[model samples]
Target chain A: MSAQRRAQVLLAILAVALIVLPFVSGSYVLSVATLILFFAFTGQAWNVMMGFAGQLSLGHSLYVGLGAYAAAGLFFHYGIGPWAGVWLAIALCVVAGAVIGFLAFRFGISGVYFALLTIAFAEFTRIGFDHITWLGGAAGLFIKVEQRDTWDLLNLRGTPKMFYFVMLALAAGAFAFCTWLLRSRAGYYWQAIREDEDAAQALGINTFRWKMLAVVISAAMTGVAGVFYAFYYNNLFPEQTYHISRSIEIILGPIIGGLGTLFGPILGAAVLTILADSITEIMAAAGIEVPGVKQVFYGLCLLVVIMFLPNGIWPAIARRLGLKDK
Target chain B: MSAVNGSPILEVRELDLYYGDAQALDGVTLAASEGEIVAIVGSNGAGKSSLIRTIAGIETQRRGMVRFRGQDIGGLPSHRVCELGIGQVPEGRQVFPSLTVRENLEMGAMLRRARARLAQTLEEIFELFPRLKERERQPAGTLSGGEQQMLAIGRCLMGQPELVMFDEPSLGLAPTIVQEVFHTIRRLHERGLTIILVEQNVAVSLKLAQSAYVLENGRIAMNGTGAELLADDRVRQAYLGL
Candidate 1:
């Protein structure tokens, strides 16, 4: 078969497997799959800016935290449903992204400095949220989970199975969106800018405007993930949600899977989450209590992946399977 | 003020450029008329590339005016300048290395003027450089130096630009490839496109150009017909060893 045909067959198989997963698996496996999907969605969001546009943002957790707070604060206090509150979350994240993009792109701060600016903004938001007592401040905000027999899909309150499907839908939606973007004019322009900004400008691409658009779109998408995170976990803590470590975890999927490819983030998320979960489970069964074991495992995985497959696991797999990686 | 004279397509007046505290261009003034080739010949660090970059809007001038077809275009971004029909085949043949040759060519036709004629233009370009057609699916990075330079020039042409700036078009190419590049430039001129040619091969550039300027220490040292400059003793001593 041709590479494209082989890739299509593989995609069909993967889709069928994911769709039937919750039917055959128990609740534990369902929760892990949901976590994998959540990371995949967020990772795809972060990938657009860094992978496609070559703007590295190390503080994507800022958008996720902001989106969670905006939606959860409304749902918790004003009794607004997440479906309604998600728009506010998206807007909040877009504004924040614009501010950062403007400050960085307009002022000619790029590369590592731009990344530092993102981290600084996340840190500032985290510290600011810590003092806001109305939303429970640093003590953490809790959403009262009512015992409901029926699955609430609209309000985003559902069992592990429902949440798994929701997350799957999210990842699939992001994949479709990114696929469309990669084939669009903006996608071509973004790749050109990523390859060489000066050359892209010489060819009539408005690098600044397109770069801002990338950040805005990425932030808006990340906000949706935030809304799902708040409702699924039933709690929001600034320290846990906005932490730099959380940002790292979100990006790890894309970096390990494939930076710019459509399926990289999802594959990376699945591999990392499953392996991490399995290792943790094994440790628990052995009755060993280790601090920062998850972080250490992630670091080791990154190192191993970088050493073996410098381009990421997905590209290697794609090459072997005669698939188009990007 | 120039030998090959017509209505000026591009005009640079009293252009001053600075990098940090050091000045790169000082009171540099030149113009290229419609349907003629203008050669800029100077030694390394004489600011030929800087002048081309400034006119292309890649580098902002500290002071002075860059007018295209009698309209002031100073302070406009590079993309805006490109949209207004200024194209540049920048120094070092800066092709998108990872992209396929065809994709790189497609990137060039991004201008509104070029978009409508993309297919026609691609056909013409393939006819002009058959090797590009042969390597259409190959990554540009894998191409030979001559091929990459052709790709760069082809990319600039893809923008459907009326005025294309050639910066060191012959730099680092083999002798035969340099001949091919100059031949392409000559053919491009014959097609009614005005050209701004910068070259390290002073003798050949002057021979091909109608009017020429010798830039020294960021200032125009001599401005005349290519023949006059070629025959001048000072030009021969400084740029040409003859």
Candidate 2:
């Protein structure tokens, strides 16, 4: 099939999945699905820079926490709806991401140093938030609870089905945005810079500006996911929301699925999340309890995936299915 | 006021360049006129790349004046310097490896052209390098060394540059490929493009350029018309080895 046809088919399948997911799931399953969708959304955002643009960010949770905190703090203080908070969250993330992107690229900090800088920024943000009592500090802040029904769309305190659907929408949006960016001129610029920045510059690509664009867009999308996470979980703690583990969880999908490949993040998320749940179930069934087994599993999964399938599972599957690159 | 021809398309005066306390280029003066092919030949560590890079604005000169079209561009950024109509086919044929032959060419016009003219420019580049047209969608990295070199040259031409500098255009290639590249360079010259070529391969560059300069130990060891240098006993002994 042509690239357009293939993209259309993949998108159609994803649309069908999003529409059908919440109805088939139980409350607990729906909750897990909601989390999965949120991670997938954020993962796609991170993938835009790290995977496609080749500006690997290890501090992606900075944007996530910023988005979540921005929206959550606004809503908590002003009773603003999730719909309104989303924009502010995204805008804030964009500005922050642009700043970080500019500093790194302007100074020519690339490769592992760029990754370290991102991590450092997120850590700094976490520390700042931990002491900021306005957002409930380390204990975290929760929305006000009254006798409202679980389907409070305005308050964003909805049923598992509601959260699942909202998360599905955000995830779909991210996937679509990534698809468009990858296929568009902007995508070409990003990919070119990612492959070889100096060559990109020689080609007259303003590497600084384009990289900033990637950082900002990716950041804005991740921020929106933070808003989604805040509403879905109804709480935000510095450690939990801004944790490095969250950053790792967000990137694993893109890394395992296929860095720079559309649908890679979604597939990676589905694979990693489902396999993780199944592993826990198998462990429980065998009555073999292991300390921090889940963390070990996540690490091992990343390690094994990187060691064997570095380019990603999607490319392997795509090749197996006789699908050539566009 | 150069006595021989049109105003200098590029001029570097009293250029001094250093790489971490090691003076690479010292008091070098050079000028390239419109429609002229000027070659700079030097052996390894003889400051040829440094001179070209300093002129290209990729490396800063501590003391010098670089003017393009009579405008001082010494302080300009590399991309801006390129936007001022200076295109560089850098050392190592550094094409965007993951991009297609077409996309790599598209990047060359990224400075001042639009999406509308991109198709026209792409076709022009394909016309300039037919091998690229054959593999427009193939990853540049996957191309043979000769094809990659063609793609690199085609990419630089897409900018429609007033002045183009090719650094070691024949580096690390088969003799046939090298000949093909020089032939392309000759063809490009026939089309009235200004070029400044930096090379360690002295004989070939001397044959192609109208005027040439030889750099040795951070200074100009020789400078004259290509025929004059070719006849010089020093150039013949050192570079041509005849």
Candidate 3:
């Protein structure tokens, strides 16, 4: 293996670190770990479209919000467990994904226009959900607190360690899935469409169908992350769930880690989670808390990543470790 | 006319195509038979590209028919058209830049063929373009213009297409590489595969073509056997620069 490929192997080994992390850390540390795993999942989900398929979606929060709402509503009222709720959320997200994909790919919207369409869909859903009360208006809804250590696994309620392990498993699964897809024939078409849509189409790529698959996959994955998000936070609100800020949070990991690289989202999540925790702790200790600090931090990180290492940090770190795919 | 024994591989009749408000091809009619190398030569903006694009189903035709293997294909999508054993190496070497040489070729065989058949096709492509095999892992964008053109042709050939359309395959290549591309075309021609070569390199095309058509402003300006066109004083003055 070349230096770069050796680095990817190292990354796969880093999964061991994640499994061991929760045991060594206190509640605060585990909290941060959970956040990292959550965002890493979101990042991988976002990478499905923005990285592999080259479709920029600045409104991924729509899927998250829809998933959270669908799952939470079912669990709260219909007595549905998260396992069933998750599938329902995915189906709903797929329908939404197809609609959005149709509008963007079929109508030939790309780049900034495509980004705008995603944002519009997200914002519209947020407002509409805020008004729809059968689930719960924007006031938000909380889960019924079960007996501590009663540990309802079916309901996705359990020990913090349980949640930690589940999230880790999910993050790993997503990474594997995206990596395999990239190496597959479908991945070839996605990359081709990403690089040049017209060229891909002329090569008989069937750009529309392939792009729709990207959207559906990304949306479905994001929807799964939404279920996890709802369960972890024990709450759901349309405004918070579907907000543009949430969309930014979802993409931050892949953007920082490495776009289109399997390990990039995990790496990006680790960096951002650590940085966000430190920055927040420092500001609180200094008693000079600024409004929207996380947003500002994300913006700064994006700028720095773009200017410093535009391809993301994975290739550089992978280079040092002697892992080159080619 | 004797090329296919009876049936033409592709036939377009009074096809009209428009781009937005501009008429790109106006009532154009053309045909190509199996086992023939048909050349369409025209100056820039002469609708040569549009003619093939219409036949390939990339551009929608407003009037008339595009019959490929006796089926009216004017309404079909490009991918469907491709799956019917007709593949187009579109204008410019649109090699997927991010894809490795091998991956680019693999994607070319993505239609209905199994991996085993595709593997066989890859062997043939490697035999045709050894440089591609040597640089299998390299990104196609980094290749030289000549190599990129060869990769494009090799990629389309990976589809095992019976009827292939090459648009400006000789563009922006060194003279030596241009001859090499023509030789490959000749080899395919000899294998009984039908080919439509849209080229501005009139001499090389005329040398290889059995029949030739001149597209001017989306209309057929002249059509005849290669020998007949070569002998015409008007063709010699305009295209051959006699």
Q: Could you say which candidate leads in lDDT?
A: 1
**lDDT agreement with native, every candidate:** 0.92, 0.84, 0.86
Q: Is candidate 2 or candidate 3 better by DockQ?
A: 2
Native interface contact recovery, all models: 0.78, 0.62, 0.47
Please give the ranking of all candidate structures by lDDT, highest first, separated by commas: 1, 3, 2
Q: For each candidate, give its TM-score against the true structure.
A: 0.97, 0.94, 0.93
Give candidate 3's TM-score. 0.93
Query: Across residues A246-318, which tens digit of lDDT does each residue of candidate 1 receive?
Result: 9999999999998988889999999999999999999999999898899999999999999999889999998
Write model 3 residue lDDT over A185-292, tens digit each, in one string: 778788888877766766677888999999999999999998988888888888898889889888889988999888788889999999988999999999986998
| Candidate 2 lDDT score at position A296 | 87
Task: Give the lDDT of residue B207 in candidate 3.
Answer: 74
| lDDT, candidate 2, A1-326, per-residue tens | 87557756866886897788778767767766776777688778998898878898999999999999988899999888878999999889988898888889888899999999999999989988999999999989987654334687766775677777778878887877887888887888888888887777776677888888889999999998888778766788999888888888889888888888877887788888888888888999999998778778888888888899988888888777556432
Kindly list the per-residue Cα lDDT of model 1 for residues B105-181, writing each as its tens digit.
99999888789999999999999999999999999999999999999999999999999999999999999999999
Binned by DockQ into CAPRI classes (incorrect, acceptable, medium, high), candidate 2 is medium
Q: Which tens-of-lDDT digit does each residue in B1-242 have in candidate 3?
A: 42444678888889888988999988888788878889999899999988888877778899989998888889788878887878888777888887789988987888774345988889988998899999999988899988898888988887778899999998888899989989989998988889999999987797788888888888989988777777878888998899
Clashing residue pairs in candidate 2 are none
| Residue A278 in model 2: lDDT | 82
